[model samples]
Target: MLIAAASTIVLAVVVWATVVNTEGWAAVQRFFLDPAIALEYLSKIWDGFLFNLQVLAISVVTVGAVALVIATLRTLRGPVFFPVRIAAAAYTDLFRGLPFVIVLYIVGYGIPTITNTRFPPIVLGVLAITLTYSAYVAEVIRAGIEAVHPSQRLAARALGLGYVQTLGRIVLPQAVRKIAPPLMNDFLSMQKDVGLVSILGAVDAVRAAQNAASQSYNFTPYIVAGVLFILLAIPTIRLTDWYTARLRDREQMGSIV
Candidate 1:
């Protein structure tokens, strides 16, 4: 632990020294770290960040529900369900392979063009996030479901449990434990991407920072916005690490040498 701390301090000092020694360091600091500009724009950027949180809250619920349905469809057995599984697979493959920014553009721009109606940017952002992240999350859930031993399903069937009952009671709980870490990671990614609503013209944190930068010609607001996001993610990041460690310990408790 002492060695690790010493190495981290040395790395920090080296990085600081290198950055401060640069010829453009003064200009860089003036543009990106001006305390006055950051303070001036803090409230506006925070308001915009609140919009990001609202979008994230809505997307989380929708993504979980939609992904679960798609996963269940993918996991269904027998030739009769082949078409359903294929459709689900196609959806996951298509969205997973597409860049999220492209998906955002298609859903954000294409929808209004086709329907001839304007939707709010926040609404469009949530829809794009849902469509894209649901595909990624569905695959995670499907893998979790499949990771359960086949014998568990067989035993549930022998006890007269129906398919849905068996899944809900005997499978999903275990799958959730196994997949929680990855799911949290996806959610962390989603939280950051929620700021992309600015592309659709929403006055989100990123947009607010852009506006501030335009007015002051200083990039400090952008840095402030980024710092805010980092601050927001810190708790979730720590929680994910703690939970992953706890889960690993539990799994290895009896078998550890």
Candidate 2:
């Protein structure tokens, strides 16, 4: 603690000395780190963050649900379900191979062009993010499913469990638990990807910041927007770390439940 305090104090002193140069400090103060400008921008954009959060929450839930279905389909065997499996494979491959921007543009603009009617920006954003992330989430979950011991499935069958029952009762629970950290990490990514939907002209934080920056003729609002995302993600990062540690502990000690 003492060492950290001393280092912080030393760093503060160095920064203070650097800023002591009046001309350079004035330019820095005028452009980037001015407290008043940052505060004003924050105030303007804070409300728009609610939209981002709304889109993020909706997208994460939808993607997780869709991906679970897709992952389950990917695990199905037997000739009867071969066509279903092929369709699932094709869906994941198509979406996962596309860049987010290209997907976003296609959904946001192309759909409107075809239907001759534009959906709400938030809706378009949610659709794009859900489609894009579901593929990735499916792969994450499929990997978790593959990592489970084959004996678990065999034992489930031996116990008179049907395939669906085995999957629901025995397999996915362990797989999801094993992959929770990465799932939450993707959610962290989803939180920020919500901002990308702003390209469709949603009143999200990024769009709000862009508007504020235009009005002010300064880019500080963009910095404020970035800082907001970082601040929001900090808790998720810590939780991911803590969850990971707990998972490691569970491996050595046994399942929490």
Candidate 3:
């Protein structure tokens, strides 16, 4: 009964949207019919899109590497590990608490003012995202590392493996497998967060749409940008879902065995 009601509500929404949002519908139609215009808009945005991708890719890779190191250090038992863990915790808290837009502004505008050096917009974008997401990724990685069985750690120690060796050989490989889905989800999030770079006048896809909309005095370009983002997100969502299912299946099989 609830499902039926929800379906009815959704259908009603579709009908209402079609009826009320005539301009949006017309924009969609215009976008589809004018191949050259759409292509030109896309071309203008392509460089920005590529820059966004570059920022996401570089930030993810760099942040992942740093997070892995921090997670490993945090897992170790010692005075050294205590300070390292506290620092890692602080870093994660600081970035995660702050808004990304504020971070971008600080990096893009504030840093240059303080340091008397002008960082490129893309560089600032990368730094802001890396600083923000690295914290979350660190926690994700740390949880994954902790999820590994204590027995594995003890066994490795008994086999005369050093702390680093144990983590390198046993802990990380298993933890990485477990965290693969969450990590991919983070990548998807970062991809979307690339739009935040637009605030810094980075000329990314969203900015391109804004420019086109301003010049054309129509909303079609913005709609096209939304469609493009959806197109990118859908595949990542599917891949993450598939990976999560596979990991769950593996866990179940291991339990049975």
Candidate 4:
């Protein structure tokens, strides 16, 4: 079933590429082959690309920090943990339930309307992606934390280590290794989600391409944008696969030893 689905997707992509090449090749040539025209288009795209990178970097870091704190609180099992757990659950549900565009709108527009303070488009874009993806990262962190053996925690407690001490010293380190692959995947998703911020009038790569296409009445800029995204995403996907394989090999070696 998976093979069939994959084949279908490949076939569709090939057909789409064929159509684009046939119909859009003139625009592609005019936009890309003409040095002056290409440079002009590329300059606009460069600005957008920089903003996209900024948004991705800021969002990933913020999300990672927020996820770590929330995941830690969620993993703590006790009466004192109840409120944190509830808050975490609510956060995960609320963000995950909302679409990315809606989140961007709220952060970009809604907050400013209420507070009468303007937020930078890039800042709002980063906040939207961070808030949305943190829930997913929180789950990844929670799973990683749980993967640490109960015996390890008990042993830490027996050795006069407090909960925080044991978690920081032992549990989180182990959990990080287990969670690295998924966390990388989430970052890749965030990279793509940067395009969603374009809807909020943030001039991201996609938006720049859109403006170019609209002004030129040509599809080549959009195609260029797609290619750029693919170029960026391919490396991350390969790295994620490499890291996952490395982790698996280490696990196997330890088991054999």
Candidate 5:
């Protein structure tokens, strides 16, 4: 432990020294690390960041609902449900294959053009995020649901539980526990991508940074925005790591020797 701590400290110091010793370091610092500029734009960027949080909050709820429905469809059995499963599978494939930027452009701009109905940029941002993330999340959820042992389902049925009841009472709880780590990872990614809504002309943190940079011709505001995002993500990142480790320990404890 001592060796590890010392090595980490040395590595950090070496990297910091290398950065500071670069020929263009001063110029880079002047442009990208200006304290005054960061301080000046912090308020505006923070306001925009609040908008991003709002979008993320809405997208998380909608994505969960949509993804659960898609996953449930994919998990349905019997020939009668084949088409539904196929449709759900196709939806996940199409969205997962397409770049999120393309989805954002389509939902944010193309839909409005086709329908001739202008929606708020925030609405479009939330919709775009939901459409894109729901696919990835649905796949994760489907995998989780399928991971449950077949015997569990059979046992539930033997006890007279219907399909929905078995799924809700017996299968889903276990699946959620298994998928919690990856789902948290997806949510972490969502936190970062929420800023992509700036491309839709929403005055999100990134857009606010862009606007501030344009006025002063310095890149410090962008750095400030990036810092803010990092700060916002740190808590979730730490939580994910802690939860993953706890889960790993629990699983190891339960495993047969």
Candidate 6:
């Protein structure tokens, strides 16, 4: 009640101040509430949004597959496999340490130059997002693998399961389940970070907004693009919250049973 009362009082004061301040009212609406351009932006930005969705879908799959390989490599044992482990560690460290934009530049522009190849900008966008995000996802999967009880591995071996079988049958599954929430978090981050492909000149939502704004010299297009992203993101956000809460409840009760 106290918190609600305080928030209401603050909101009332802010609204009153805005209503009385003619300059502030005009400025806010000029940037954000331009009805004349809203429909124009809505039509153009949706085309770009579809491209964003395409890249996101492809990047998610690429990251998932590549991350599992890297995570498995990191968990390898035996002196003969030492080089493989070091290589995997180096990959994760190198990509994770670099800013996503730098990685995007390297893969998006550098690869094309080196290979004398051309891919549509959306392909480059997915590749860049996949490369950067795979490293992080590998770490998440590695943590999940580690969180599986040591005893499970021991039990699997006692039943004559090989190391590969033990890990595949026993550890990775539990790790994935344990790390689902964190993985979802990275997925959400990827949804926004996909926007960085604007640097590559892909006409995704942000790029569409930029193109629209350039013609008219108003920021309404950017606002529309942002609103589109938020609208798309909200359902996933709510699902994540509900899933996280259910996980907490299960943990507190010590299992679904």
Worst 10 residues of 5 by lDDT: 248-257
Off by over 4 Å in 6: 1-22, 254-257
TM-score, every prediction = 0.95, 0.90, 0.85, 0.84, 0.96, 0.91
Question: Which candidate order results from sorting by lDDT in descending order?
Answer: 1, 5, 6, 2, 4, 3
Best by lDDT: 1
| Candidate 1 residue spans exceeding 4 A from truth | 1-9
**Where does candidate 1 have its weakest 10-residue lDDT segment?**
248-257
lDDT of 2 at 89: 95
Q: Give the alpha carbon lDDT tens digit for every residue of 1-257 in model 6.
A: 99999999999898888684667878778876798887877888899998999999999999999999999999887999999999999999998999999988998889999999998998899889888999999999999998888999999999999999999899987887789889989988998898888888788899999999998788999999888888878888888888899888888895455
* lDDT per residue as tens, model 4, 1-257: 99999999999999878966587876667754444544558878877888888888888789989988888878879898799899888998889899888888889899889999988888888888988999999999999999999999999999999989999998999999999998989888888889888977888889998898788766667766766778889999999999999988987885763
Q: After superposing candidate 4 on the true structure, give the runs of residues whose Cα lies further than 4 Å from its correct spot.
A: 1-40, 254-257
Against the reference, the lDDT scores of all candidates come to 0.96, 0.89, 0.82, 0.85, 0.94, 0.89
Candidate 5: regions farther than 4 A off: 254-257
| TM-score ranking from best candidate downward | 5, 1, 6, 2, 3, 4
User: Per-residue lDDT tens digits of candidate 2, residues 117-162?
Assistant: 9699888999999999999999899989988999999999999999
User: Taking the tens digit of each residue's C-alpha lDDT, what string does model 3 give over 137-185?
Assistant: 8889999999999999999999999988998899989999988888888
lDDT of 6: 0.89
Q: Give the TM-score of candidate 4.
A: 0.84
